[model samples]
Target chain A: MKEIVVISGKGGTGKTSITASLAYLGGKDIVLADCDVDAADMHLLMQPDFGQAKDFYSGLIAEIRQDDCIQCGKCADICRFDAIPVIDGKYIVDPLSCEGCGYCPRVCPTDAIDMLDMNVGKWYVSTIKTGTTMVHAKLGIGADNSGKLVAHVKNEAKRIAEEEDKEIVLVDGSPGVGCPVVSSLSGAKFVVLVTEPTVSGLHDLKRVYELVDKFNIPAGCIINKADLNPQVSAEIESFLKQENIGHIASLPYDENFTAAMTQGKTIVEYDENNLNEILTQSWAKIKQIA
Target chain B: MKIAIASGKGGTGKTTLSTNLAAYLAEKQEVVLVDLDVEEPNSGLFIKAELLREEEKYKMIPQWNPDTCILCGNCQEVCNFHAVLKLGEQIMVFPELCHSCYACSELCPTNSLPMVPQKMGELKHFNSGTLSFIESRLEIGQEQAVPLIRQTNKYVEECFSEQVIKLFDSPPGTSCPVIEATKDADFIILVTEPTPFGLHDLTLAVETMRELKKNFGVVINRHGIGNDEVEKYCSAENIPLLARIPNDRQIAELYSRGELLYKKIPGVKEQLDLLIHHIEGLESAGER
Candidate 1:
């Protein structure tokens, strides 16, 4: 199955809205993966049912057994993260600060600390309103290992796509050039970079594109809110030309994006003519190129 | 006071608020604006400051020493990140997956795995009058942003006096990078737009801040475009509504050209003033 990952270096650039529209247009032939586990919002639009849920355990967290009488501060000294602290004369582990490096457990004199797999989040495999399977996850509050959760979601989507013989796996990637973004881009057949026409937008687009360029994946550009700034839009087009990235489409900034989101609908379901045609054509072009 | 301006979603005016707020406050008092969004730092694109210094940042990773090596497989077993693997006679170290906790180097039976510094990113310092701007950018293809952000916070602490107010423009999303950026701040300003995506991510951010137990307020950007659900949510949650930057075309145009909005736009300036006033209130309360 061909995997088309839609990513925006900058957030709130209509990445989710556009991805949802594309997924809606793709219909039953695609499997959707929302790899933005830190702040997963695709379900807000897609309305995926959380029927099949699984505990996603990644990395490790240090748990101190209070039964073993050890307030010796040995674990506190070796913890580089400062995760262990003396609270009311008892050494306790702060779940948020702990890095689970396993140094404290080895140094504990009484063996009070045990390194256990942390249930950082939960992933779900469910059918959305469009009759396509969506693999998404929600990261626990203040939890690390989001990159692992993103990889889990992607693998599940790809596995289901292969099993069901789906034509494509459309992934909504997280913003930034960090670990989660890197994990979302791994093993993708093609990339769809959604950006806007602003100073920060272009700056981030170039930065994220640098990451994507390292992967050697074929990429196309979608300039959302192109009318907001014509000069930057032109600059973005030229940059696309210079970088050899395909110019898919330029979508005008519209209120329908927010309106549709508020009504829990995709742009394809909300707008019948203009946005529908553009997104449908964009999906077709992606299939042709990817 | 160190104030961090962050958002749950990107392109929601973190840089816009950071640059303009620093500039406006710098007119009277000393301020340091730090762009902690190492992956894609854009505050420097707006601020025109003279370069003070530049430094290359590095992170410690395990380097195998063949002479002192023993095939104990201790490093592989102890490593929780899957960064180190002992295959046959060679130990492979994946720097991207390593958290630099020094577990492998310290736990090795022999001193086979030595910790060494590898170049990861660069940190630059710039100055414009009383406003000092610092930006740290991660090298492309680098996966970890927490180490660089931690180092940048250390640099800021060592270089600037405690009296100066520091404003950190943090990366978007509620993740490790965001946590590292806001963990030490005296207060955080969560900038978000008024939309479903905004509200959704805002709630997630609120949960993160609460988990971190941070003193934070909310600022609604692009206020006129979307619905008022964000305002209602803040009211329900009792999160302080800091200010609302109206959705103005001129503001967008000014921002597109890398221009500061508070000086040209009256609406934006008013919001900045309100923010400054609120910050001052927080400052006095802290002193009390």
Candidate 2:
């Protein structure tokens, strides 16, 4: 199956809006994957019927046994993160500050510290309006290992696509060149970078392009809000040409997108129908290139 | 006092609010704007700042010497990030995955591994008219940003003065990076729009703020463009409503061109002024 991951290095660049439209137009044999675990918003538009979520276990966390604590303060002194705290006459381990390095356990003479697996987040498989299996996740507030969560969601999407005999996996990637974005692009067949026409957009476009380039993935650029600044859009076009990345589409600055989103719909599903033609054309081009 | 402008969702005007608020606040007080979004720091692009200093941040990673090694594989076992690997007789080390916990070198039986400083990112200091700015730029392909963020905040804390009002432009999302950036802040400004996505992510951010036990307020950008769900949610949660930036094509265009709208947009300066007073009120109330 072909995998097309939609990414924007900067947030709020219409990655979800465009991805939802594409999934709506792509019709059958498509599995939608929302890999923006840190801020998964695709479900807001698709309004999927979510299934039971499974807990996601990531790195270990240190927990000190209260009964065996000797309050010698050796673990506190050696911890680089200062996770171990002497509180009220007993030593305690702060789960938020612990990095699961397996260091504090070694330094503890009383063997009180035990490294335990942490449930960092949860992933779900659901059905969207287009009858496509949508795989998404929610990373717990203040939790780490978003990259691993993205990987887990993608793997689930791939498994469902295989079982259902789906032909394509449409992925909605997260913002920034961080671990989660990297995981979304891992082993993907193609990448469509959705960016805006601003200095931050241009800079983010370059950074995410470099990240996709590192994985040697075939990628294309789709500039959203193209008319906001023609100069920056032109610069973005030239940059894509220099890098030989395909210029897939340039969507106009349309308020219809916001209107559609506010009504819990994609551009294709909205009653206004202003953004339908451009969105269909973009999906056609994406399918042809991807 | 340290105030952080943050949002669970991206593109909610954290940078816009921060840069403009800092510039306006500098007119009456000594202000410092620290952009903690090191992965994609764009605050530096909007502000015209004079270069004051730049320094490279580094972390210690174990460097294994093959000559002194017996290939015991103890270092490989102790590493949590899988930065070290043991082949038949060779050891492979991946520096990018290292967390600099020094567990590998400390656990090495033969003392073959030694800790060495490796470049992680850069911290920059700048003077933008009356405002002092600090930003961290992580090297491309780098995985972790918390260390660089910690180092930048360390510098800010060391030189902190009683007269300066510090504003932090935090990264999007309620993950570890956002937690690290806002941990020490006196107040947090959660920026959001009025859409469903905005409300969804704003709920997550509120959970984070409550977990941190930090006082916070909400700023609604692109108001009148979407539904009233966000305002309703804020009222239900009792989060103070600070300001509302109108949804106007003119404002979007101004933002696109990187113009400081506080200077030209009608009533924007006054709204920001009111926001400053609201924050001060919150602080004074907290003290009482």
Candidate 3:
């Protein structure tokens, strides 16, 4: 099966909205995976009928037994995150602050600390309105190991795609050049970069593009909110040309985008004529590559 | 008194509010502005400060010695963070994952492991005339922000005397990094716009500040363009609304040009001055 991963270099760049529109048009021919576990919002727009929530253990969370401990202050001193607290002459680990590094347990001379593999997140295999299977998850607040969770979601989606003989897998990846983004881009057929017309947007896009280049992924760019700053939009186009990246399309600002989100619907369902055509044509062009 | 300008979502003007507040406050009193968003440190975009000093700090992690090492795997088994992973025959260390707890070193059967410090990032001190801009730049692709933030606190404590009034530019989110930045701040100014997402995230920020037990007030940015959910939240929570800046095109243009908004908009300075004075008064009184 062919694969396409859509990502943006920055947050709030309209990656999910456009990805959902493409998924809507593509229908059951593909499987959808939202790998932005840190802030999973596609479910709000797609209204996916989520099913089978499984407790996912990513990293370990240190638990110190206060009764079995001495107030040596070694664990607190060694904890790089300051996750451990000195309370009433005792060291206690904040579940949220803990990175599960297990270093604290070793430093405790009294051996009062033990590592606990905490349930840090949950994953789901659901169906969006377009009759396509979707795998998405949420990383627990203040939790690490997002890259592992993304890989897990992608593996599940790939299994379903192969089982159903789907021809393509559409993934809505996270923003930035982080571990989670790396997992989403792993072995993907193509990457569609969505960006805006701003200095922050271009700077972040360049950063993420360098990462995509590191993986040798063939990529294209979609300049969203192109009209917001035409000068920046032109600069982005020139940058794309200089970098040998494909420029897919430019999108104008529309209040309907926000309206659709407020109504808990994809932009395609709200105004299928304009932006939907852009994704449709882009998908068709992407299909010709392989 | 320390005041942290924080927002739960990025691009909602965290840096914009913090830098302008710092610039405005520096005119009267000693002001220390901290850029805690180490992931993409940008407060220096406006505050032109001279480099004073720089230091490199790291989170301590157990360095395993192969000479005295036994492959008992006790350290690997005992580690909670999975920061230490025994892959095939080689032990791999993900520094970003390490919290420097020294567990592997203490648990090594052959006494082969020792906790050692490695440079993870740099903190630069900048003196811009009156305002002191303290910024910590974490190494790129490094996920150990909390450690750097902890180190950042040490720098702030040393540079910002108790008498100085400071404004800390916190990273967007109610996450661990934001928590680390705001833990010592005397007051928090939650900067937010008016939208469903804004309101949703702001509520989370408020919940976090409340849990931290820090005195907080709301600052409505782009006031008239959005809705009233944020105002209503503050009213119901009994948190005071400190200031409001309307959605003016000129102010937006100024920000786009990398200009400080408070200087461009006369409306902003008066509100900030009032807010700063009120915070000082509240701090002296020891009242929320």
Assess each prediction's global lDDT (C-alpha) against the native: 0.92, 0.89, 0.77
What TM-score does candidate 3 reach?
A: 0.86
In the predicted model 1, the residue pairs found to clash are: A11-B10
Per-prediction DockQ comes to: 0.75, 0.80, 0.32
Give the poorly placed runs of model 1, Cα more than 4 Å off: A67-69
User: What are the per-residue Cα lDDT tens digits for candidate 2 across B1-288?
Assistant: 889999999998999999999998888878999999989998988888899999999877888899999998998898888999998889988987888887888778888989999888899899967799998988878888888888899999887685578999999998888998998899999999999889999999999999999899999999988899999998998999999988888888888878788999866787798899997886687678
lDDT of 2 at A210: 89
lDDT by residue for model 2 (A1-290), tens: 99999999999889999999999888767999999999899998887898767889999999999899888888888787777878888888887778889987888888999999999988889888887789999898888888889998999899899999998999999888878888899989999999999888998889889889999999988899999999999999999999999998888998888889998998888944546877888888888888
Instruction: Tell me the TM-score of chain B in each candidate.
Output: 0.98, 0.96, 0.94
TM-scores of the candidates in the order shown: 0.97, 0.98, 0.86
Error of 3 at A265 (Å): 3.2
lDDT measured at residue B104 in model 1 versus the true structure, 0 to 100: 91
Model 1 score (lDDT)? 0.92
Candidate 1 chain B weakest ten by summed lDDT: B6-15
In the predicted model 3, the residue pairs found to clash are: A60-A100, A100-B81, A101-B81, A103-B101, A103-B103, A104-B101, A106-B103
